[model samples]
Target: MALRLKDQLVGQVVDGRYEVLSRIAAGGMATVYLAADARLGRQVALKVMHPHLAADEVFVDRFAREARSAARLSHPGVVGVYDQGAEGGTVYLAMEHVPGRTLRDVLTERGALTAGEALAVVTAMLDALASAHRSDLVHRDVKPENILVGLDGRLRVADFGLARAASASTTAASVLIGTVAYLAPELVTQGRADARADVYAVGVVLFELLTGSLPFTGDVPAQVAYAHV
Candidate 1:
């Protein structure tokens, strides 16, 4: 079943530029594929938005805006954005394909890290966040899943889908962004977030790295979020 699903778009071309090679990963918003850029003659991670989401004008606009914002950040610790567009109802973002495992995968396998190792990882993540903050962007979601640990011992933060301009009014009572385990108290209580919220999440990640367990956990997401308050 999984193999059949993986072969679905194996040979398809997106935007007449990126030729899909294989499936890399799939998340709630999109499926990522290893693709060959016919124009540049290089490899890229093609993030294709799910059809249901591509059908939403608001989501597509926001996705494009994220590409622009992330592209503006030129930092070693952040994944690079190459291009974004929609072709035949297929909205996609072409990004630098970093060959690595996510921090989440490491934690899941190793259970925890030494204090020195944890500090090193967190420092790299902070450096990336610092660059984003300087660009007036706040990475509202700062969980392990968004952090990539390269084979060369470098760390790069990815997925700015939940990021927004720090100056933008980040108050949404109707919507909650970010993982519940790493959410800040202000985010849980007021539905407000800023650069400080990112910092708070970083602290939570630090704790998890050191202890191999989240500071807060509950049977349901609401319960976990409430504990942050």
Candidate 2:
């Protein structure tokens, strides 16, 4: 077998504060790592932006917005943001380290959930989104991948990276911000998203949790997005 390469950030200290422990996962925009905060002596989930993305002003602004948006809300159902900073070219957000799998993982492993379990998960997600709505924030993206289930059976909504102020207007012409399957129709057609869009996504998630499959599927993301429209 070919040898696996080591992650460069695994042992590096970020901003002279967060000591990167190990990579948790990598997404299109960033890589999440289990990290140690030297000052507070605690563990945190460090979401570091990809170097290429960091170089783009738009992505950098979005990264900063995530820190600002999540920091404004104080809800147990939502993941907490501890800090955000950059060292050299590395920009990162230090957030609460939720020790468990994502809702997506659960769905993949268990197929479907019982009614009680589905209700519990959806309730937690709604509560978290309600908190964001009250703060004038729209999550913009709500999917199973963004829902983290703690080992203690607690569910938290995470990844406010796509969130924007409710007053902000969006157009379909702009870059798409959410997953296709869970996207609200308005979001797919006109690109407008508010609390209602989040609610719509939650409904889709609830359906998937109980049915073990998305209501719509297609060979391409555009086809799935078109279905939402």
lDDT of each: 0.80, 0.80
Residue 26 in candidate 2 has what lDDT?
70
Cand. 2 Cα-lDDT = 0.80
For model 2, the stretches where C-alpha displacement exceeds 4 angstroms are 1-6, 163-178
What are the RMSD figures for all models against the true structure? 3.5, 3.8
Q: Give me the candidate number with maximum lDDT.
A: 1
Q: Write the per-residue lDDT of candidate 2 for residues 1-229, one digit (tens) a residue.
A: 0011116788888899998888888764568889999999999999876666666666666667767878888999999988988877787889999999999999999999999999989999999999989988778778998999999989999977443421132332233433788889987777676789999999999999999999999987889888877
Candidate 2: give the clashing pairs: none
